[model samples]
Target: MTSLPEDSPPLIRDNDRDTAVGRLQEAYAEGHISHEELDERLHQVLTAKTRGGLQSALASLPEEDAGTTSTIAVAGGRIKRRGAWRVPRILKVESAYGTVRLDLSRAVIEHPVVDIELQLGTGGAKITVPRDAIVEFEDLQTGWKDTRYKTRRRPRSGGPRIRISGTMGFGRLKIRHARR
Candidate 1:
């Protein structure tokens, strides 16, 4: 990914009221945007004072003309699945502020992975792993009460030695070994 320069302008732009309204209408019609959606977007754009706010709203609502695959929500959250698991090689995880991943591990197969190296960006987590699992020490920076892990369920498969490292702000991470 191309990194934006520190001095570069923000992704969200402040649109003039009249021009923005016109574009909203045009996008609503030729773009086939619903009146309700357009109104919501208009409200967001109007209320947004900073470029970040404007950009966030725009990113959440994509251009009507451009779209590929729809998103399916899982575990009361939006999720995406990759290829089927085969011997469970390596799990590549990346995340930003306030986002969590791997919500289906406990729900799906029990202890299907043998090894994992978790490289987190900036976020908090509450994770549970099988008991008797060996974890390795890794280089990481974490915040106070940001990570909590615990294990309650019985162990199905021998959990891999998890090594986690990353920078965090304000959150809690919990890890515990569940006895199966």
Candidate 2:
């Protein structure tokens, strides 16, 4: 079991709380728990200050429904995810001399946060999320040409979060929001 240090701060990240809430919601949606149970768990998750507390709040929940891993790899063609497609918890997109677009406005988001690993070469990748979605880009190592990116909103409550990290070489990575 992964446990936090005893002397460390009791505060947990918002992402953790959101994840716990998402689990409770999933349990309710799957009929694994009743409304009362979901309410109780939501309360506990919202008030959880430590990692142990958060874990306890989600202890009674079942594992998430596993599905096929969504991997989009194209060499000189356009790759796009739009409409009502299911958004995987972890997505991998690799493009070369092509364009990759991931639009999440009407997508089904099972997880509170989505992780993306993008490897681009001489191509471009565009991720279009809802206006309220939270996007965090990090560990972006670019070669030759630096990456050109922009985000308008910070990660906020009630909105799904997207964390993207990876490499781009002589390519472009654009993060834009869908018009409300």
The candidate maximizing lDDT is 2
Give Cα distance to truth, residue 81, candidate 1, Å. Answer: 9.1
Cα error, candidate 2, residue 158 (Å): 4.1
Q: Relative to the unseen true structure, what is the C-alpha lDDT of residue 119 in candidate 1, on a scale of 0 to 100?
A: 40
> lDDT for every model?
0.47, 0.80
Q: Candidate 1, which segments miss by more than 4 Å at Cα?
A: 1-87, 101-122, 144-146, 149-159
Model 1, span 1-180: residue lDDT tens:
998789866453322443355456666766657889888877977887666655554553435332122222223232234223222334444444444444323433322223333444445554444355544333445655535544335544444445545554555555555434
Best by TM-score: 2
Instruction: Please provide, for model 2 over 37-147, each residue's C-alpha lDDT reduced to its tens digit, 9 standing for 90 to 100.
Output: 888888988887788988888885777655446788888888888999899988988887787888998888867678888888877777888777888786677777655
Q: Distance from true position, residue 170, model 1, in Å?
A: 3.3
Q: lDDT of candidate 1 vs native?
A: 0.47
RMSD of each: 17.8, 4.7
